[model samples]
Target: MTATVRPGLADEDLARLRARVTGPVLDPSTPTYDEVRRVWNGAVDKHPAVIVRCAEAPDVVEAIRFARRTGLPVAVRGGGHSIPGFSAIDGGLLIDLQPMKTIDVDPDQRLVTVGAGVVWAELDRATQEHGLAVTGGEVSDTGIAGLTLGGGFGWLKRTCGLACDNLLAAEVVTADGRVVGASDTENPDLLWALRGGGGNFGIVTRFTYRLHPVGPILYGGALVHPAQRTADALRFLREHASRVPDETSLMAALVVAPPAPEFPAALHGHPVVVLGAAYHGGLAEGEHALGFLREFAPPAVDLLGPIPYVALQQMVDAFTPRGLHYYVKSEWLADLPDGVVDALVDHHLARTSPLHQILLHQMGGAVSRVAPEKTAFTYRDAAFVVTVAGCWQPGDARGPHVEWARSAWRACLPGSAGGAYINHLDADEGANRIRAAYGAATYDRLIAVKAVWDPDNVFCGNHNIPPGHSGTRQR
Candidate 1:
């Protein structure tokens, strides 16, 4: 794969871009250039020729215009957490939105308006202050823009919908450098597309989300069992989770116990199967809902109880810290066949790295209640999302780890819905996978929307949806 030749920007062009916005325009020679180009994934090592740390919408507009005029591919960086490094580019323009982290919570209307740069942790803290929240990523460090656009899933998803489902409005800077708004009463078609249509259309500057009444503290934690008990644990989870109330969201994982103070020293670095349950309603009711799992079997560690929502959100942060070499392969399963369970257990036991984890997140609650046509997200009917993640330190060889995830994904594909979560996809998964992420009907509709908003495919760095043959490239 040869690298694309980046269109050169003349000195006058650089000066013009600098004069058009209030933000600082950094070139590769700048002292902070390398730091600005670094994304959360250590595997991506591209260096953009220019980086614009946008201060506001106007800066974003100027940056897009600069890219268009110079013919430099544009990459938008929100939380810099793009798993495949879509946020960074080689010798192109990187629109860095990290400086635009302003959040305004309107408790009166149960709405929270946040800048695209805001992460889930910041939003969770602010919304929890007023006893309200929207569905956000489990990892608090994930950016709101990328996660929501890719159809977010979190602990609150069963009780509430996905993050995109709660999105009421958005401010986007289109390909032609015009600021536009998308909402129910505004550009509703664009709003529908923005809900789950990756960044192919434009750059989102702000988002307004509808909040739901939730708790600052919820009964949620993990119950760990021995690795050999994975099949039994998963079988119990499958039955129990199917009948669990919407207020209860469940996730089962095969992970190695880290050497943290929370785990027993004897079990440190040991492989374990954990059933993590979170109930969003009253503490007593939550405990009642989670009682079966607590008493089902004796575990090495039992950490289920009333815990702060913020603490639960940050609980996995240690396992997924920034700069780790990571690769993820996921599939949406309509039903977990018995063979799939055996394969999952076998893969978990044969994992190349102890740090690797395989997760099964129970879907179908509020997530399924929404009509598929209502938004661009089409995977609402899935019963569970199976994610195979390979993680290792910097010096580790990438082949075995990546192969582990890919092989596991192949084994589980037989029981899948033939679709995937866009956010969890890897760079190697090509355009065909992108189309599969959005079903055939939704993919065609998204193409029409992309043609209307970005005919030239200016935002091609993401899980790109190119304008089809019907679209004429706009100057």
Candidate 2:
């Protein structure tokens, strides 16, 4: 209850929020107000006195009724890749939703309804033009609605699962501004808190997945290794990422080497480890579940085979772009112990920046077959999830890369499988790691569905879910 950032709005509240938002109402004297309040993490330099570039769902219900008639503070930008700078907010009223571009494919019921500024490379190039696909975002311009409402997984997450387990319907905008519709028979507890329950309890804008038949080509790629065999490539990718096959998805990262002339100018600034396979199915069962990448060792560059599932979802789009300066710290392991590969090779060889990296992902098949109450992303037996990515670029000093990703995730939090990964946390890990990313009966049924749809918490900026009572967890 401490807003105080109103040195700007009120010329009849910007003429009644520009006569109820038709899109583009920005402030700080508009003229494109710093390019619609820049977002994709340049370590987020915010200044939101009001932005509102929303366009549909009645421009996010009149920008949540003009952020509750000017008490302001509300943020929500879809493809603005919110890595902790909760999509931009300083004295707030963001609601950008990147100009709500719509998508909508159907290909004889594979289904695909986008918009919420659809991103995962435009919903994997409009669901791969009917070859169809879904569990998206391994970076292809992330933001398939904040990675499927904060619980997405990539490379077909063990063959089709987490993207909030193929959502199916949404279109929120609640905090009293009304306009609802979640699915599986409408408002099923707001489709179980928009599947993964981030963005608190509203402002979804549109999303309705449930597609599949992946790859118009698969048996995927990458197998790197070199930084002095990165702990034997993380003990050969934690013993073949538990013997592959959920149509093989495996990941493993660790990175550094980017001097990009397609790499290997004697492994540029060193440290490698790559390992990225991706199978969806049959190339002789994805080459016998990736023949343990032809038995490990001797891999300076392997580049596996077949490709296109939209070129492996735009394969790390030139090693992550959008104004770089992302800080992550992730967890959830349930395995991969070699003191977590010597704490991720002693923090990527004690590096400070060669654009730092770590990402490990390879959780269980079909993401542990879904059922921890079927939604609100209950980790589902995490088998590996590591992150630690504290990249650094714009004028550096993000306090020594957020203290090197919090001292290498506190040396791998006693091999935690306790929590973390509400989209790789990191807005200062509050609310006790968001109640260890949903525990205690799915955070007390998302605090009674955020007290019946944002009981005045008014979508308290991303990663907050307060609305009191039921087993109580207010902060």
Q: Pick the candidate with the highest TM-score.
A: 1
The list of candidate 1 runs beyond 4 A from truth reads 1-7, 469-475
| Clash counts for the predictions, in order | 0, 1
The true-versus-predicted C-alpha distance at residue 357 of model 1, in Å, is 1.3
RMSD of 1: 2.9
TM-score of each: 0.97, 0.36
lDDT of 1: 0.89
Q: List CA RMSD, all candidates.
A: 2.9, 19.1
lDDT of 2 by residue, 1-475 (tens): 1122367556677667778788877777666788778877787888888777878898788888877887888888888887887888887888887778898889899988888987888778777878888888788887888878888888887878888888978878798888988898988888877888888888888888889887678888887877767787777777777876688887778888788766679988888888888889766678767867868776777778888788888877877788888898888878777886887788898879878888887889888988878798877798888888888889878888889888988888777889888987878788877887887789888888888888878777777878875435543
Lowest-lDDT window of 10 residues in candidate 1? 1-10
Tens-place lDDT per residue, model 1, 1-475, is 1122244567777888888889888887778888888999888899888889999999999998888888888899999898899999998899999888999999999999999999999999999999999999999999999999999999999988999999999999999999999999988989999999988888999999999998888999999888889998888888887899999999998999999888889778888899998999999999998898877789889999999998889878888878888999999998888889999999999999998999999998999998887789989989999999888889999999999999989889878987889999989998789889998899999999888898888888888887864233432
Q: Clashes in candidate 1: how many?
A: 0
